[model samples]
Target: MRAVAIAAAAAAAKARRISGRLHATSSVRQYSIMISPHLKNITLTHSDSSIYSDDRSRPYGQPLAVPWSANQIRFAKARGSDVRPGNVIERKGKVYQVVKAQHSTQGRGGAIIQVELRDVDSGNKVNERFRTDEIVEKVFVEAKSFTYLYTDEESDSVVLMEPNTFVQLDVPKHLFGDSLAYLKDDITVSVELFNDRAMSASVPKRVTCTVVEAQVPMKGMGATPHTKKVLLDNGITVQVPPHVITGDKLLIDTTDNSYISRA
Candidate 1:
């Protein structure tokens, strides 16, 4: 009878130990569930794919999967020698528009490429030097036809509308900078779109503008083809030939804002 009592006490202690282990497991699982959402948020905040990975110590285990429907930019890998002026490129995770690219070969060195870049969104300028064989990421943008609407004074943006769908979009003034002086209503302009966002706008290579005001040629100025400063209807000032006068229509090069000829 005593042996049976001892066996019963031992079985009761074993059952208690099993129950404790199951309770601990349940508590651990609940704790993990509670913390999982916070961990996910932290991962997303630090795991943006656009960030450049330069540190070797930090391990990015695997790339996050991107949806197939997401917009993807077209890019090509090319050497620094192949980059051209007016091309867009990605460098150190920043996008820059190439203003000018020059290649030179020195007597002692193999070759070098110099590039002047402007930050697409910040309007900052930077000069970069690269070896001829250095690789670069060249981005391609698509040009779409858009008609000039009116400038939004409140937002300080130029409004443009698509012809086919009449979809209106407001482009930041800084995107075109001084080039906006050439924009005119009802004129068709080319807007460079990247990832469905307007990156820049190009005015017609040649535009006709009426002379709103002109300074008369000075009498004493020698006959060395003296030029006079004239203001166009768009408020841009340019030097025109002495023959140009008020109300005269003149052909101007929008690229350089220079006088071309009498229209």
Candidate 2:
């Protein structure tokens, strides 16, 4: 009987030890499950940091380059004949847009390229001659939509705003030159921006303006290509057909400043 009691006691002690071991294992598993979500959150935070690290240093929502400027190409000046109209070139730290390019070879000199260029910032026209071996830096500019707000009489500048964001900017009047005659309140124009500054503004190809003053047409002049001088509401003078009269709204081509038709 004594041996059986001792055997029973040993069996009971073994059972208690086994139960304690199982309880410890279950506690460890519960701890692991509880910590898994925190670990996952930490990993996600690291991933987000890596993804947006570059963006944090740039302007908000601003791209590295203009979207429409992707096709812009740069050409090194190798020959005078290589320069073409509509090319923008940089010289003496000033930018100029080429309006016309003509290559000519003098009787005694090397080939010379004559280029008529318009100053990008001042809208002034200049004539330049370049040698075939001279180096020129070609630049490309991109245009954006801007709304005409008003002309600042004090500064002789035009005020414009972005169409979508309404960001306002003031551009020099000379940048528009005679094109300013076509500008009206609330008119939208294509503005070329360079270095975050307005370089040029282009009016629509055609615009309607009221004829504020028109001279009486000469009857005998009908046999010839005769046009009467008329003053527009914008104070610009243009030639119009004989039939047009005062208060007549006429369509005008902004490119050549020629009359198109009656509007």
Candidate 3:
């Protein structure tokens, strides 16, 4: 509770200053990304030269080499070229996880780093572009394991607890998207944190799902591999092979809800 209050106060106090300092570059953009049903608006701009990257410290566009661990935080300033998907950054005093990043070169405008960022607290998202040479405040976050607790519908967050210490965190639910359906009690989730705050979370790449109700395939559709929609215990309906029947277990790709194979 104390930490939440401090973070909110800090964000509110500095929000105006960050906005005042950043003029929407003719290139800056605002985006409303829906990683979940709760995402909201976004805005961004570049900081002044004072906070630009220290070129001599590292080569341009080199990715961070940190490994995953618990309760550790590392911070650095790097050029936009060095940013990548899954990296956490602070904009307007709020932290965001980079969902996607792409490098593009214009015939004359030099290199641009296009990024999609998701707010760690609100699940809101934004898209912004940066000069390859522009300095960005990068929060080096690493994934730590936590046990899936349950969703707090009122708060729109998922509760998770550290395995050893039992410390709990409320991660924004939107980070999970449709994959949230795969969550089961005591399941392990990978959460990326900076300063003990969750910036992103993911479930296992594969999950076991039960075939509850499989629709019969029509004989007219032939040649192609036969598939039919089957409901899972978690209430998700996905296509499975014709042979799959009620009570059968199947491995599902959590990333895209695709059927893998019989489990």
Candidate 4:
């Protein structure tokens, strides 16, 4: 999210903590491909399985390191118009994850795709505009399941663990933003990775949270269905129907922190 850009800058500074080791694998077949012919000198190659090449002498270019231990990595392509949040794309010799994408029309000029991108390496953010139909290198990554351990406020990172191996990872706390309140101890979280980079973290859309406080409704508080602001168990405030009250467990949309239904 655009709001998480501030947190991304701080998270990318630390060398991530890891618990498991992955061994290198044998060589695989590789080929060269480019969407545009103007930049044919770039020698980045994509193998059926591996994305990087061991050799760097070729005129084409050095490929990215292959994730040998994990078989969930995937490769794909998308136009700038189709780009959305969390899509990892490479541009100008750097890889970035899309944080926000907006489309606008400029009278007779054409459609412009405006995007906010966060660097995969440094978490630095940049705004760029692209023409519609421009081919973009999109890498579809798979998520690794981890158990929510705790939020390490001192380090500004959230700690997670592998359910099977118990290996722990400390991710940037800002990555979760306000949604951090929905996290509970030992909950399953999906972390997406690209070339060992933590692209994003997400929780289930709906989470059961108890209303900690709310005012009783009187007359028509709202022109339509009356609503009231209530505090949640995790210290997040949300607007809910007057029927909701203290001690009521209601489903909340973690994506936007909105009230869903009584749980």
Q: Write the per-residue lDDT of candidate 2 for residues 67-184, one digit (tens) a residue.
A: 2234345434545577887667788888887889998999889889999988876778999999877778876566898999999999989999998998998988887868898889
Which lDDT value does model 1 have at 65?
27
Predicted model with the maximum lDDT? 3
True-structure lDDT of candidate 4: 0.72
- The positional error of residue 183 in candidate 1, measured at the CA in angstroms, is 1.2
Candidate 3 least-lDDT 10 residues: 32-41
Q: TM-scores, in order shown?
A: 0.67, 0.66, 0.67, 0.65
**Candidate 3, 1-263: lDDT as tens digits:** 99868855655555455445443333432321112122122222232322223332433233222123432437688889998988888777888888899999999999899999988777878999989999888888768999998999999889999999999988888988778899999999998877777777899999888888877666887675667789999999888887888999999999789999999
Better of 1 and 2 by lDDT: 1
| Candidate 2 vs candidate 3, TM-score winner | 3
lDDT agreement of model 3 with the native: 0.75
Model 1 bad stretches (over 4 Å): 1-73, 217-225
> Could you give candidate 1's per-residue lDDT for residues 1-263 as a string of tens digits?
99868855755564444334432312222111011232221111122222323333433333222333353447889899898887888899988888889998888988999899988778788999989899999888878999999899898888999999999988877777678888887988888877887766778899999999987766786775668789999999999888888999999999889999999
RMSD after CA superposition, every candidate: 18.3, 19.5, 19.5, 15.5
lDDT of 4 by residue, 1-263 (tens): 87567544433322121101212243543344332233222222433332223443434334433244444435666788999888888888887889899999999989989999987666688999988888888887768989999988898788999899998988776566567778898778888877655677778778888888877766855564577899988999998987887999998988888888899
Q: List the residue pairs that clash in candidate 2.
A: none
- For candidate 3, give the lDDT of residue 176: 85
Query: Which residue pairs collide, candidate 4?
Result: 43-60, 43-61
Show where candidate 3 strays beyond 4 Å: 1-73, 218-225
Candidate 4, residue 169: lDDT:
85
